[model samples]
Target: MNKLSCILLTLLAWLQYSLWLGKNGIYDFINIYNTTKLYENINDITQMRFRNNQLLYEIYDLLHGYEAVEERSRYNLGMIKIDETFYQIKL
Candidate 1:
């Protein structure tokens, strides 16, 4: 009876070890989950930085008055100075 009980206890310990530390175990799952979360956070921060840079560039352009306005008007509204002739060439 003692030998049988010892074997059962050893088997139980091995099962516990496999459950917590084996391939695709709880520990591995937790580690991979944490790594995924860290990468997602880094991606969010990078996107935010990109947006901030774009906004800063826009603010700089806005602060530069006429050049920015004229560029935007020419491209977006197709406006021209009164004395300048407009030309459109088709390819």
Candidate 2:
């Protein structure tokens, strides 16, 4: 009877260990969830970096190029070249 009780306790301990530290353990699930969140944050930062690069390129062009300035002036001030004619087609 004593041996049987000892074997039963040992088996219960092994089962508890397997439940907590096996392939699909709670700790493994938590680690995977944390890694997923970190990757999502990295993706968001990459997108923001791309947007910032595009805006920087636009700023550089506007600062250094006559075409950019001409476009801005044409749109903002209704400007035209000396030999150009203006026609307003209103809807």
Candidate 3:
């Protein structure tokens, strides 16, 4: 009886160890989850920076890019220079 009890206790301890610290354990899962979250945040930051750069470029263009401003005025505001003729053809 004593030997059987000792064997059972050892088996139980091994099972507990495997559950807590074996392959594919909770610690590994948590680490993977944290890494995924960190990467997601980094991706978000990269996207925001790209958008920010685009906005800054547009702002600079509006402030100093005469060609862009002229095109915008011609297309969006239907503006024409004093010496230019405006004609519209419909097909």
Off by over 4 Å in 1: 45-91
lDDT of 2 by residue, 1-91 (tens): 9999999999999888877787788778888999999999888988988999999999999989999999999999999899899999999
TM-score of each: 0.52, 0.52, 0.51
Q: Is candidate 2 or candidate 3 better by TM-score?
A: 2
Query: In model 1, how large is the Cα lDDT of residue 41?
Result: 85
User: Considering only N, C-alpha and C atoms within 3 Å, which residue pairs clash in candidate 3?
Assistant: none
Query: Tens digits of per-residue lDDT for model 1 on 6-84?
Result: 9999999999998999998999999999999999988898898899999999889878778888888899999989889
lDDT values, one for every candidate: 0.92, 0.91, 0.90
> Lowest-scoring 10 consecutive residues by lDDT in candidate 2?
18-27
Q: What TM value does model 3 have?
A: 0.51
Q: What RMSD does model 1 have?
A: 5.1
Residue ranges of candidate 3 with Cα displaced over 4 Å: 1-47
Rank order (by lDDT, best first): 1, 2, 3
Among all candidates shown, the one with the greatest lDDT: 1
Query: After TM-score superposition, what is the CA distance of residue 79 in candidate 3 from its true location, in Å?
Result: 0.6
